[model samples]
Every structure is written in C-alpha cells, then in structure tokens.
Target chain A: MKFLKLSMSATAFAAAMAASTSAMAEEYKMVILQSLTGGAAFIGKNVADGAAMAADELNANGFFGEGNSLVYEVADDATDRTQTLSLITRLAADEDVLIVMGPTSGSVALAGANVANEREFPVITTTNSMEVIENGPWSFILTQPADVTIPYIADFTAQTLGAKNCAIIGVKDNEAYVALQRKYEDLIQAQGVNLASVDGVALADSDFSALATKIATSEQDCVFIGTPAAQGANLVIQLRQAGLDPSIPILGHNAFASPTFIEKGGAAVENVYLMGAWVPGGYDDFSSAFSTNFEAKTGIPADEWHAVGYSGMQVIANAIKDAVAAGAVTREGVRDALGTQTDIPVVMGEGTYSYDEHRVPHFGMKVLQVKDGAFAVVGE
Target chain B: MLSQQILNGLVTGSVYALFSLGFTLIFGVQKLLNFAHGATFMAGAFIAYYCTISGLPFLLAIGFSMVATGVIAILVDLIAFRSLRKRGNAEFPALVSSIGVDLILVSIAQQVSKTQVLNFPFGTFPVKFYTFMGLRISLLQLVILATVAVLVALLIFYLKKTTFGRQVRAVATNERAAALLGVNAQSVYLQTFFIAGALAGLAGVLIGLLFNSMQFLMGEPYMLRAFVVVVIGGLGSVPGAIVASLMLGVMQSLTVAYLPSGLTDAIIFALLFVVLLIRPNGLFGDANAVAGGTRQ
Candidate 1:
C-alpha cells in the first residue's frame, strides 16, 4: 500500500509538471524599419506607430496563440537606401528576431528587397513597388503598387471627373514620382483625354511661381500633381494664386491621403480629387476595430499609413500563428504560411484581399475629394 | 503668356536673388564656404512658423525670426568656423565643418517637426491679386519684389557708406592687414555673418509664405540654386549674384514654358558648366575670388 501510494503521488506530480509546461508562453519579436527621419519621415513614422499599436493589442488579448505573444522594435532608416540595406541585414542577422517589416517607401525599398532574398528572411512591408516584387520572394508587400493604383486614379479623373486635358508637375529626380506620373499619363491618354504639358522641378524646389503661370495659362482642364504631399500642396496653392481658375480641378494620388496636403494647401485643395489605398469611411469592420483601438492607444485618428502598418502586422502575426499551429516555428515555416494564407482579413484592401501566384497582394482603393478641409468620398 | 511668364520668373528670381545675396555676402567677407548658411535659412522659416503659431503678428514674427536667425548664424560661426579660423587654416576644414553643422541643424529640425511639413496659418498674409497688361500678379508677388528691392538697396547702401562696411571691405582685402590697421577682424566676421544670416532668414520667411510650405530640407535646393547663382555671378560678387539669380529665374521659367518637360535642372546646370568653361572667374567675379583669407 505504501509503495502504491508513493507511485500515485509521483504520477500526480509528473502530470502537474506537464500541465505547467503547457501553460508557459513564449515571446517572439519582430523588427521594423522606418524612415522616422529625413524627407519621408512623415509616412514612415506613422506606419511604424500603427504597427506598434497592433502589436500592443495582440499581446494584450493573446491573439497569436495560447502561449505566444508578439512584440516589435522599430529602427529609423532616415529615408536613406544604403542605410536601409544595412539595417535590414543587421536586423535579419539577429537570431531572436522573428521577422522584419517596413521602410515605408517603395523607391527606398528596392534596396532592402535584395537583402531579404540573400538572407532568406521574411520582410513583410507596406512598400508598394512592383520592381521590388521581382527582386525576391522574401519581400511580402501589403500596399497596392503605384502602377495599379495610379492608372486607376487616372481613369477616374479622366472619366468620372471629365477632365479633357491634364497637365502634370513633379520632381523629376524621384523615379517613383516620375513613374507614377508616366502611368497616369498613359491611362488618361488611353481613356481619350488629351495630354497636356508635364512640368518637372528639381527636388526640394520651393517656389512654383513660374510653373504655376505656365499651368494656369496652358488651358488644361485639370492638373495631375505627381509629387509628394507637401510639394503638391505648395504647387497647387501657387497655381491657384497665379490665376489658375478655381473651377479647374486638381488631381493627385496617394500623397493626397496625407494630412499634410490638406493642411498645407488649405483653401486651395478644395475640390481636389485623389486616390486612397484605404478609405476610412468605406467601412471595413476590421479597419474600424483597428482604428478605434489605435486611437485609444495613440490618441490620434489612424490614417492610411496607420492602416497599412496595422494590416501588415496582422498578416505577419497570423503567419507566425499558423506556423506555430503547424508545429514549425522556423523562418521558412512563417514565410510558407504567409504564402498560403487564404482570404486573410485586412484593413486597407477592397473586397476579398488575397495574394496572387506572383506573391503580389491585390486590393481595391477609393477616390476622394477635398471638401471643407476634410476628405470626402468622391461619389458617395 | 510670355510676358506673364517673365513676370513670374522675375518674382521667383527676386527671392532667389535675396537668398543668394546672403550666401555671396559670407564668401565676400570670410572667404569660407559656409554650407550651414542653408540651415540658417531653414531655421528662419521654422522660427517664423513657431512665432506665428504662438500668436505673434505676421510682421512681428518675421522680425523675430530675422533676429533669431541672425543670432543663430553667429552661433554657427562660433561653433563651426571660429575654431578653424583661430587655428589659422579655415578653408577646407571650415567647409567640412559647416557641412557637419548643417547636418546637425537639419537633424534637429527633422525631430522637432516630426518630419511633418509646416504651413503658416491661413490668412498669415493677405492674399490679393492684381492684373496689369494681361499679366496676373498677386499682391504677395508685388510685396516680394518690393521687399527684395528695398533690402538689396539697403544692403548696398549700408556696405558702401558705413564705417563697418569699410572695415569689412578692408578685411576682405587682407585680414592680417585689416587687423594690423586696428580693424577688429573677428568683429567684422561676426557682423558679416549676422548680415548674411539676416538676409537668408528674411528670404526663408518670404519663401515659407510664398510656397505655403516649410520643411527641414527646404533650404537644400535653394542652396544648390544659390551656389549656381554665386558661381555664375562671380563667386564673391554681390551684384553678380543678383543679376545671375534673376537671369537664371527667367531662363528657368522660359524653359519650363517652352521646352520639353523635366529639362529645367539640366538646362540650368548645363549653363553653369558652360559658364565655368568660358569665364572661369564668373561674369562679375574678380580673378582673386578667394581673397587672402587663407592664413594661420
């Protein structure tokens, strides 16, 4: 009886130890790179904050798994391509890191894509460069490519807004802006709109007085601003001040999503139309939840950058959780899981967001108009 | 349209001339390239922006920003160039040092702005327009032209008539000789820096308003354009900088209007290259553009 009782006690203690082991949770960390400084810092900083907000909520609610939590660290790239390259390599080399995300710019992300492939590390980012997709499979992008979105916006401007001729102006040195403008021109011409003159300025150019005069007198029905938010805003303001008829519409792209455009352009941007990757008013349940939670944490209403960042984080966490569920926690396992993710719920895309065989994520967008210092859905 | 474009160019060029004049002024006296001059320009805009948001009147904010930037320019000299100047070999080292200081200032600005572009509150300046001879011009443009003219005239008059001007010219001719002749060389340097910085600051405010946007790196392109203006104007010639700035502005405007798109910088830089090849000393520059400031 004594031996039997002793055996039973040992068995109970063994079972208790096993139960405790199962209850223990492990922490995983992902590294994010953003241009928290330099020219692109406005977007980079917001995206990083959005990702951080998502990670916080996931950790609090234990969304990853029964015993797993997600945490993140953000490193500033300062919008330099070479620095981004170095940061990606360094972050990937860290054995404790689960994944890497972001640089917040498509033009700058071209450098990081090569590193991701070489390191065989998964770099999920909101960088929307199609050329980056060709670089390697390691880079999983969340934002719609400029080629896809710009053309769509151009069609809307030419067709819906009824612009007969649209003049273009932007910094010539920026390949991204140049590419975007070229795409817009192509689409508008395809839609039977006349192509007006394209005005190009060097980067960091302040005064648009001369360009404004040319555009105002050119008789274009509309003008497509192929520049960043700040530059575009200043240009439009100058154009209006230089006697461009306020009746003529102004067209823009993702840069208009930035609050800077409206804030800086003020009365000038009224009635301007632009495409957004995410329309907050479009009403996605997931987006709404993320916005509410993010506002609660950061005290600022989440915008496009925030939505992209949050969506990217959710995708990463879901991939990791899938890898964990399959009992394969390796980097490759996480990457493969991302590849096979089906019908994943996201905040930014329209109508059944999913990845194609080429590893490019496809989503829909909206065209918005500036009304009374706020963005209103164009058709709605 | 052609006349309108010319007017537009002149208006834009006036600001360029205002900005370039300060840059040339520094080279005129100290004979050292203060790349940090751009930082002072950026700072002027920022200071004015903050002052405006703090509820200071527009004109008052402009004055405060001017004073603050002048002081900031002096501080830049103290930190970046003075030590090198004291050591008696200030040229290359000063250039490198000024570039370093420019980076630090830009970095600090980036942090302060959180990388967001700033705009003055609407109605910071009255927006009124005028049309004459089929050329439409805003009241702001008229003000900019008048401001540039008045400031340039005042600068020229001050340099030509003042005792301080004589000292500065004496130092420009020969720092050691000026020091031997009882001209306080250091004081002259500080004064020139202040003047240059004040002009740059004023230019910054005008630009911040004209463009309706301000960013940490806003001064960079102006610096490049101003460098071209300074080089083409003859490195240390104030008059040269003004004429070249206006000419470049008109040419740039014309090119954008008539030429193929995206050819403005190429045309400008090509002109710069041609000028360098043809007149090495520049259109108005003297042979001794460096002056005899290279001393120990």
Candidate 2:
C-alpha cells in the first residue's frame, strides 16, 4: 500500500512539471525554403547555413525572450520553380510558421512570391531580381536590384575608368545574366561608349577561346563579363592567356566578388572590378561581427551570397523580435512588423533596412576590386 | 580574323578527331556505340588532373591517365557489354547498358570531386603566343596539334602493321569465322577497347588543358559532338573522322564568329540533319554492312 501511494504521487509530480514547462514556452516557426540540392546547391547550402546560424544565435541569446523559442522547418525546393511554389504554399498554411526565409534563385523566388501573396504570408528572398518583390506585397528582397547596380557600373566604367570601347560577353542560358547584359548593352551604348562586340555563350561552356580571341582582337578598353563567377573566372583567365593585355580593365557582376572567383581565376582576377552589395569590413559593426562569426564557423571568408543570406536572416529575426515585443507573434503579426521595418539592423551594408511600397529594399552596391587574391573596396 | 578563326577551328577539330577516332574504332569493331566513351574521357582528365596536382610531372601524368582510362574502358566492356553479348541481346541493349554505366561513372566522378570545377594550377602550361600574317597562335595549340598527329599515326600503325591488328580486323569482318580460325575474340575486344579508351583519355587531358577547366559534366558536350563526328565521318572510318572533324570545327568556328550566338547550336545540328538526309550511310559508312550479301 505504501509503494502504490509513492508511485501515484510521483506520477502527479511528473504531470505538473510537464504542464509548467509547456506553459512557459511559446513556439514560433520560421520556414526556410531554398535549394538544398541540384545545380544551385552551393548557393542554397550557404544560405541555409546562414539561416541556421541566425536561428541558433537567436535561441541561444534569448533574443526571442525568456518564455519563447524559435523553431525552424527547412524545405529543399531542389531549385525547381514548381516545388518552390508547392513548398511555399504548404509552409504558409502551417499555423505555427511565422515567416518564410527564401527560394534563393531569381526564377524560383519569383514563383514563391505568388504563393506568399495568395496566402498573405511574409517571405524574404535572396534573389538578385527585384521582380520577386514586385510580385506581391508579402515579399521582401534582400539583394539590390540589377537595374540599379548594373547602370551604376556602366557609369563607373565611363566616368571613372574613362573606357572608350567596351566589349560584352554574357552567359546566354541564364535569364538573370541575360537581363543584366541587355541593361548593360543599352546603358553603355547610350553613354557614348563604343560597343566593340556583343557575344553570348552557353552556361556550361568552358572554351571561351573563341570568344576570348574575339575580345582580344577587338581592342576594347574594358570587357564586361555577365556570367556566373565560375564561368567569369574562366573567361578572364582564358582572355589573359589568349594574349589580351593584362592591364585592360575587366569588369564583372556582383557574383565575381567571391572567393570562388579569386581562387579559380588566381592571378587573372587581380585588378578585376566588380559591383556588389557587400564590401567586407566596410560596413557597420554588425558586418564585422557577422564576418568574424561566419569565418569562425565556415573557415572561409564570407562572399556576397553569404552576405545576402546572413542579412536575410537578420531581417526575419528582427521582425520576430519586434513581433514578440508587440505581444503578437503570429504570421500576420510578423508580416506587418516586417512591412514596418524601418531602421532594422542588417549585415549587407551600413544603412538600416527600409522597405518601399513593394517591399523592395532600397539598397545600393559599392564597387569592389580583387587585389592580392582578396576582395577589397575599390579606391581603397 | 577569318584566318585566326580557321586556325582556332583546326586546333579544336584535332581534339575532336582524337576523341571521335576512339568512338568510331569501337563501333567499327563491334558494331556497337559505347555511350560511356565520354565518361571514360572525363575519367582520364580527372586522373591526370589529380596526378598533376599531386606533384607528378605533366608528361608522366598524361601517360598514367591514359593507362588508367584504358583499364577503365576494358572494365566498362566487361560489366556493361559482356553479359549482353553472351545473352545474344540486340545492339540497343548494349547502348542502354552503356548509358547506365555512363551515369554510374559520372556519379562517381561528381562525388569524388564534390562538383567543383577544377583547373590545372597556373604555369601547368606556359602562356606564349606566336603571331604570323596578323593571326596569333599559342605554343599550346602547336603542341596539341603535334600530339594529336603523333597519336593518330601511332594508332594507325598499331592497327595496320601488327598481328593483333590483323586479328581485330578479322574479328570485325566476322566474329564466328575469327573464332573458328582460333582468334581469341574476347582478347581482341579487350585490346580494341583499351586502345580506344587511351586515345579518348589523351584527348580529354589535352582539351582540359586547352580550356583550363575540368568537371564531371565536361565530357557530356564533347560526347554529343563525338556522335556528330563519327556519324559524319562514317561510323568506323578513321580517315573520314579526321577529315569531317576539321570540317565541323571550321563550320562551328565560322558560325560562332558570324551568326547570332544562340543560333550556333541550331545551325550545327541542322548541318548534321542535312548530311544525314543526303548520305544515310554517312559519308564513308558501308552501304551494306552485312557480309555474304543477305541470306539467299
């Protein structure tokens, strides 16, 4: 009889402890949607790492407050647009999910924006295209638009570099690069810069010999490369090998300001200029702190993609913090708070986060140059 | 500009000929297409790349890669084609089996390299240019042309002047008759596959050096072009493959130089379609592949 009484009391105590623990913690979910496999795996993996680090930091620091916890549900879209749409819809419908993080590629992000708008859920994307945000009110873009960055680059080429004849080579298969190339073509031609030649190559093509030969013979003062970092590096190296003047100005998109470019291009990338969103150590304290943490964790210096992803997580984390402060941590609450996020701390650059009516972040890129196999701010 | 483009085309065509010669030689002997030829090509470059990066001399690396890829090709035959041949399966089965092996090889490569585009360290080859008649050529290009020429001559000498070459030709003419005459058919297959793979491996290494990039998927595009080269040259005609390779290379170069960049592929394939329409047997293919003139 004494043993039975003890067991009953212990069961009662266990039940009470469970109830208290449950009441003490409130769970909010942040759904991370991005490509974890397929061709975009490199970018997607970095983005997911950044998001995971952000979540870990927030939970560890009690950023969500004493009685609150943030949970992450990661979904791999596999870099497919249809999969992105379906996953975004499913995440939006989940009652515990407060916000969605990304479908990092431009095409997938654009499709995801449609689902977010329909479900009235908030999404922050790391794609370079502004069209993703323009798709809906619930969308926020982390990277600066190509329209803003590309034109600035063209002007810089004309005004600062004093380039007369500019040659352009774009990867034709990529829609983002094509759009960027078209914009550059128009802007440079309009700026009275003589267009030497406009050429395009397939995405996986490594033999830029044919194109490099053309560019080398054209006598262009500068060459604009609108390909991905890997391909761009190949072009730059092959161009130099094909007997193009090493001192000739070579310019590239934001993607070129990456360790991959430097590592792959080796000595070829020295003096190559890039227009990108982040300049390492040039931004605020948060930028330095983020860089230190990222290098400590990843063992490599952060690139532009890492910056976009890290800043993307900061935007969502800040929104969640604001929602918890306001006593409303629902999806609607997070969405509204994110919409009103003016002066929210981010790691991309110095400016505080402010969103326009379309929720597109008004940010600009600074010019960066690769010197001694590292990215440094131009004119530094 | 045109002269320079043509020179560039010749350099590219030589590499294509080196790759296609192996593919055609295999098809000529067995009347089967080895889709895994491309994967074998890729493996050669990858092996050579690892060897070079691991501090081996470039020449030794090339030799090692060729031998390794040759062994791999023999294994491909043993695994993919041998069982089907024993079962008396049609040609299509061999094609399907080779594709499966190709996927397996490519997957292995992707895993090994982690899908990164690797480059030979700078100074693996010097960057020197020679200009003549207002057209520039690199020392690397000259070396490539010489390598291809020497390799082709060696292959021809091995096929035409050796006892094993006679056995291979006899087997190609009739497997049953060759077997009856005491020719070891299996050995012939092994020898042919080895030779073909070695040539492809060498071509892959050279192309990798030329482009300064090597990846698992790098073989895929070249494989597609190999099909065109072999088909246009007549499936199994070595001399025809060499000639057609040069022509296709010149055509591709001229198109890329003059036409809209997007239309380059379309135009090349269209040229292939026209060739097929005009010569269904390919330029040098046997009109009647069957010996003994169809059953009476």
What's each prediction's TM-score?
A: 0.92, 0.85
Scored by TM-score, the top model is 1
Query: Candidate 1 at B142: error in angstroms?
Result: 1.1
lDDT of 1 by residue, B165-208 (tens): 77877888788898899999889888888888988999999989
Candidate 2: which docking quality band? acceptable
lDDT tens digits by residue: candidate 2, A73-180 = 778887788889888888877777888888877678888888888898888876767787678778877666666668868888888998889888897865567778
Models, CA RMSD each: 4.7, 4.3
What is the TM-score of each candidate's chain B when compared with the real chain B?
0.96, 0.95
Distance (Å) between predicted and true CA of B201, model 2? 3.3
CA lDDT, candidate 2, residue B61: 97
- Report every candidate's CA lDDT: 0.81, 0.80
**Ten-residue stretch with the least lDDT total in model 1 chain A:** A277-286
Model 1 steric clash pairs = B88-B296
Q: Per-residue lDDT of B119-212 in model 2, one digit per residue for the tens? A: 8888898878898888888999999999999988887887778888777777777888889999999999998899889988998899889988
Choose the strongest candidate by lDDT. Answer: 1
